[model samples]
Target chain A: MSGVKKPVERRLRGEAVPALDVARIRADFPILDQQVYGKPLVYLDNAATTQKPRAVIDAVTRYYEHDNSNVHRGVHALSQRATEEYEGVREKVRAFLNARSVRELVFVRGATEAINLVAATFGRMRVREGGEILLTEMEHHSNIVPWQLLAEQTGAVLKVVPITDSGELVMEEFERLLGPRTRLVAVAHLSNALGTINPVRRIIGLAHAQGVPVLLDGAQAAPHIRVDVQDLDCDFYAFSGHKLYGPTGIGVLYGKEKWLEDMPPYQGGGEMIRQVSFKRSTYSDIPAKFEAGTPNIAGAIGLGAAIDYVQAIGLDAIAAHEHSVLEYALAAAEEVPGMRVVGCARAKASILSFVLERIHPHDIGTILDRQGLAVRVGHHCAMPVMEHYCLPATARASFAVYNTREEVDVLMAGIRKVREVFGQ
Target chain B: MNDLRDLYQEVIFDHNRNPRNCYCMKGANRTAEGFNPLCGDRLTLYLKVEDGKIAEASFQGSGCAISTASASLMTEALKGKSLEEAERLFQAFHGRITRDTGGAAPVDLGKLEVLSGVSEFPTRVKCATLAWHTLNAALEDKGEPVTSE
Candidate 1:
């Protein structure tokens, strides 16, 4: 009986690296194969930005080489090719998110810009004076500041749902905060500083029950887990391509078709407009209405290739491999004296945010960097989460599909070196 | 390894472990706050100036070994020094940590020379210089917190 369930047991025990060939996956990212400070580089900063795969790089290069032209409004062959490739990426992102239609996805500069787009258009329309925009304590600054700007403009109040000591959102607080005055609920799908996988589905359900629309800040979540906008029923969802192994300066804002039809154009320019007059000007449809000028054509095409790459390998396999590596890192951290892992959510992704007793995270970062280990050491643009934990900063070592247990071991050794250097 | 050791020398660890004059002054006339929002290093510098010379210097805050040690050693060095001399010392300290030296004679910073290793690690130079910038603010009575953005 034990032998029969061996494979299943191995997975449960977090020995599931065999789900995907990490060694072969690592080879796809050329930047991972290098040295820093005479030591082999162990990149653990995926939460900041991921290294691009050859597929993504080749896609961007191919766009520049073959089909470099202004998209739309051009009668040339290259223009048609460019426009098709750019529009094809929108379809790819639409299918990736399992949205109802390609009309839902609007490409912006990144998740930050996506949130700002919603705040400028949807938020300005729905939120009124004295109405509240509810958010959680664990949101990144990008999620918070945009709404703050909106509140400042419209006299709307910002209500916060508190989190537990374990970094999980207090559902009771969220329920209490969700009231008649709530206009929109914007929260992180996954906390970047703590790696907490928030109960966004339940949050969405609670908000929808109150007839309040919800927008998910999926900057950290989209790259790790499978996101279905239709299943979650979130009014809007935002994520960055750079964090998802695609090019920078490009992201997606997935909005429902009904809402997209109602909201005004985020920016006014050439492509977003249908007809312009001296007195009156009309705008384009859902996506083109949001996309104002010539967009990041190569970036969107690269994101398309990125979607193809991840889909070929499968997100489930990637998630399983990262889970095992995170578990191994957590276990290995036990041996390091004074080591404290900050986020202890039962459901989490692959980020390991921690702090050493009496040792500043910047020092830890510098020492680890000397050993060719790259980890983010700061508030991670989530200062409110740091304030919730009563910490100034944390040293974070985040994992990705290409990360390995062996790299985690190197990180452990580097952490030990940090303590030794500090004479702890 | 060598560069890391150079940057994080024994004196820096000593100063970090036992930061001197790490307390808010009760009767201070000149004061300034230093903040590095990126790394979350923050400190309040207090100076008791009498007759163009520093009578007492103290600070209280939290930072990494580099910034904490620089502040600690700075308070110790500023005691009984003339205002002009302190200005010279700040310039010398800043120059030492930022310039290449290029086989030229090193600036005479006394105990503060321990931080000269910060030149090898470009990112930590701001850590080493944050306190001195705050000192300049204190001297000028800037009335606003100094930020190393």
Candidate 2:
């Protein structure tokens, strides 16, 4: 691993902390070197999806070029090598999330699928017709829709905890809503649209007090925060690899050993069963029970490489660097007249969601695209949050480890150009 | 910035800032709502038809500059036109914006031709045509809201 202290050493010496060697970090991501619309590309859409480093790219390429075989059932040498690489990634993911065991982690398509798996299996088993599934207003659609489907199927009611105007969760309301009928409490660890870092540890504690299992949607958190599922004691945690600078089509769902054992298999397919017969079939244990058919072997290996890449730089360093950059951006935003930031939580991450006066987000997005600043402009799949704010959409600029203060300046300049275009 | 300028021309900015007849018309015989799910742009079209001709047209909604301008200009161009002419104009406007000129004789779109730049931005074509789609739905009396998916 890279020297973790070298990046933040100045802080220890009572001096101004030096920024991460972003030049070196930027060099590792080959996609960051490209140009768009005759200007150097400034990618601020990390919340939507992060760009992959060359290490991850090469790991996936090497897998497809050399070790190309199905996992587990292969008796050939190539198959054995592929299975070793594939299974090794499970251990890496376990360590990345600091989970109890690799068996507790199941590889799914993405965070969306991981939540669906929990909702389909655990939700189907635990929630009764009158049971309540509690959620927050800031949850992404992935976390909300699955439970809605479960509620629709079982006639269970979905109770929502509201957020404050500054995008912080109303903790008192959450405590009040954790009633006797509440079976599950699912919420986002970090708001994708608002950049609010939710107090998931407290949320888990309250839910555990009520004997309710809390499932955390870490799709936005895992990329920026240090996620220790054990420390938080969350019953379930989910995150996508793509947002963590890894490949798409692969993610991790970390459930407690007991929960994984109690929940039925999400899908029945080859390799998930121990023995098939004419009568009934028994399923394999935990991870294998959830992973059905041919998995994304290369994606898993690439995710392992991604974990290694981020670990070497250190999560603390990444978080500190992104936090400083976000702070800088927020301060710079004050210079732009008529600029209104949508979310102003006391604690936030690398995302900056804001709106310029009267100019629509789409127009801002198009103008920024011409200036080679890629920002996400929409409701960010959190329509309820938009409705709460009485806005159709807001332009979002999310930062990653590779983002620099200079790029944030360019973004601010792009907003000024948008104002010029709209005659604001 | 030429393309940006073309997409958000001064005229577009003007209409977006100060839309004409941008209100719910009273005593409207035909009304329909349009929704662009991609960007959450929505508008309601109000038309007053008399003796097979449109006597008044107006709309009220929130959308991007391109969409707002297209809607405002559409209300101006569509007034005092027969239903048949409106349909033909829809076809011509759609054809011009979508670049689907399959050897059909081109119809003069007049002021609406400024939106021809939308063809370059395939994504914004929906924004440009949302008002026209609502007009179509209003004329047909399709009570259901039209969606540009």
Per-prediction DockQ comes to 0.88, 0.85
Q: What DockQ class does candidate 2 belong to?
A: high
* Chain A fold similarity by TM-score, each prediction: 0.97, 0.96
Flag clash pairs in model 2: none
TM for every model, in the order presented, reads 0.97, 0.97
CA lDDT, every model vs. true structure: 0.92, 0.92
Least well predicted 10-residue stretch by lDDT in candidate 2 chain A:
A1-10
Report the lDDT of model 2 for residue A155: 93
In model 2, state the lDDT of residue B32: 98
lDDT of 2 by residue, A216-258 (tens): 9999999899999999999999999999999999999999999
By DockQ, the best candidate is 1
Q: Candidate 1 lDDT, tens digit per residue, A1-424?
A: 2332344447656644346877899999999999999899999999999999999999999999999999988999999999999999988998899999999999999999999999999999999999999999999999999999999999999999998999999999999989999999999999999999999999999999999999999999988888989999999999999999999999999999999999999988989999999999999988899999999999999999999998888776777777778877877887789999999898888899999998999999999999999999999998888888888899999999999988998999899889998987
Badly placed stretches (over 4 Å) of model 1 are: A1-18, B100-106
